[model samples]
Target chain A: MKSRKSLGDSEELKEINISPLIDMVFILLIFFIVTTVFVEEPGVEVQKPKAASIKDLEKNSILIAITAKGEIVFGGGQIGIGGIRPTVRRLCAQEKLPVILQVDESAPGALVVRAIDEAKLGKARAVFISANPI
Target chain B: MAIKRNFASSEDMTEINISPLIDMVFILLIFFIVTTVFVEEDGMEVSRPEPSAVQTMEKDSINFELRGTQVLMNGKNIGLGAVRAQVSRLIQGQDLPVIITVGEEASAGLLVRVIDESRLAGAKNVSLAGS
Candidate 1:
């Protein structure tokens, strides 16, 4: 009888209380959810020009990249100047996010201008050109 | 409450299965951790002139024409280094609109640098035009 009672005691001790673990996990999950901003990133990188008159832009805005070869990229795919208006319009319809143009230093000015004009036609709240601050 | 029934079922009813809940929470945590971007971009707003909003050029407005890699004012080449000094001197104490007419083949980098210099020189309204 004593051996059986000891076995029961060991079993009870083996059931480690996991409520605290669950509570910790819950806190972490909440933290991540609260701090997440679901902005679609442009996958390609470009050599941005350095400028003294730059400021921090909104974190939740649309990002479009212009490569040195004059390719307009949005969310890892190459899009033409004609694509800007529809893409920006579709995104802005869900939420009014500003459009950010990350242009390579050597990119063509005409393409950049067309992209900006298309973004405006898409009803972007504002348009910005990304540059590295000196 | 039935005391006899509760006593018989005490061991089995005390613990609830939470492995699935934990699995779900872990998945959510991993997804968010992966998607988070820590780099906040620094940029400048570009207000391009629209055809409908074209107003008559001011008498004191400054005109800059960017062709290829050269910056020309009234067909005279002013090197990039001279942009700031010349603009500051030209603006003096008045707010003059600076208009940059960019050729289709001009480099975006040079245009941006010129715009930055013009702004630094205290031009209140810097606008772009296409040639």
Candidate 2:
């Protein structure tokens, strides 16, 4: 092997620095984490009844909308009424996500109640009605 | 020159110390895991009660939204006057909480009867939609 230069006396070797690389990685990770917005999945396509005092819903719960035409839409799909309970049950068993009920002004009352019953069957602790700002 | 030197050393020595990277990755994964979600879709729908020319509800009373004179609690349909009992059950110890919802566009009287039932059920808090 070739004789190595005198490491210190010749001033040829440099310090092994990983601080800058670590710093750069940290910045990128932070940016990715910060800019990411977590949007909750709305389980149904129910038309929400409008209210004067309703506020823009905070996006941390599953939104379940029931349309006036009796379409049970979820995650943007139309599910029939009989399919609701088991679906909610399976979903809650998998992940106990919050449920928000968005009912249109023209929807059937009993149907709206049925949705809430399903939400209860799913073991959801709270079911919020989606209301609009007046 | 300094940046180039750092890059050069990193490229020359191929093996990366992945232990810390793995640890960090797992931590982030755990965080997202706890925060992940599944959605539930139910079939219930409600047409908001419409506005009518009626008396403004009392300032301190609980409101109930009943359909066809039937009551509801947490989405389950209950019998007539059942809403008041349910409201009392929810707000038993506290004063009546203000319950506000629109009146059915067709029937102002039905909404009033529901309001009356709320009072009978001991609504320390109740309110009607509009006058």
Candidate 3:
């Protein structure tokens, strides 16, 4: 942030008013904070994959937890391929359920893919694999 | 005395004006917004437990232990053809809250896929369990 001053007049120099600018900043900060809604992943604890280049998402929907030992759970509850569609449908109907798959480092790809497939089948619009930022 | 015209020039103003400060503030806001990183959690955790529990897998689940000719479902040894047939019928209309247990072993060949295929065959829920 840069500023300039008006000189040459000792008695009445023109000064730049900054109170409005500061006010604007505060408004924007508040707007971003208020508009952003945080979402928590459900089910068991999931250790996310690490990536050097990961971007932040503003909002997310449903969450799936994958343990390093290869156990998959969701919504604080465990379900299998048989139980996926109904749960997914229930979640998606409320909202488009932007799914995030939090996979453990040791978890295999086949399981992750299956979850994604189920979410899609349940009518979820988008599915993102959770990864830690670098 | 002429006062030497005072040494200060119009361009030599020492005090800074703050209009440009607003521009700088906006620039910073844009930078932060563009650089911020956000993340979403993965869906769920499905793990294979150690084999020692007395609890049994779901009666309707197509539990398979693939050791070439040693295919099993629901704790019974069966042929591949029969296993497939059972899976196709088991995952019909059920969804959510149901479970399909898969065993965990470094050498549990085809068990993972069998679990996946069972899901594809129509199982609503799939999980890995200790057999």
Q: Model 3, residue B87: what's the lDDT?
A: 67
DockQ for candidate 2 = 0.06
What is residue A9's positional error in candidate 2, in angstroms? 33
The top-ranked prediction according to TM-score is 1
RMSD of every candidate to native, in Å, equals 5.2, 13.7, 14.4
Question: lDDT tens string, model 1, A5-110?
Answer: 9888889686787889889988988988888888888899899988998889998899999999999999989888889999999999977889999999999987
Q: Considering TM-score, which of the candidate structures 1 and 2 is the better prediction for this target?
A: 1
Ranking by lDDT, best first? Answer: 1, 3, 2
Question: What digit string (tens of lDDT, one per residue) describes model 2 on residues A1-134?
Answer: 23454555556545466667667666655655664546545454433443332334434556666776767777767777776677677767866766676666566555655666677667765555665432
lDDT, candidate 3, A1-134, per-residue tens: 12333333433736556687689896786565555555544656555555432345436576667676666677667776557678779877867766666667557555555666677778877666666553
Q: What are the runs in model 2 whose C-alpha is more than 4 Å off?
A: A1-47, A52-58, B1-131
Error of 3 at B35 (Å): 26
- For all predictions in the order shown, the interface RMSD in Å is 1.5, 10.0, 9.2
Q: Per-residue lDDT for B28-109 in model 2, tens only?
A: 7556555554323332112222233123334333455454544544456675557656766766777745453532331323
Which of the numbered candidates is closest to the native, going by highest lDDT? 1
Binned by DockQ into CAPRI classes (incorrect, acceptable, medium, high), candidate 1 is medium
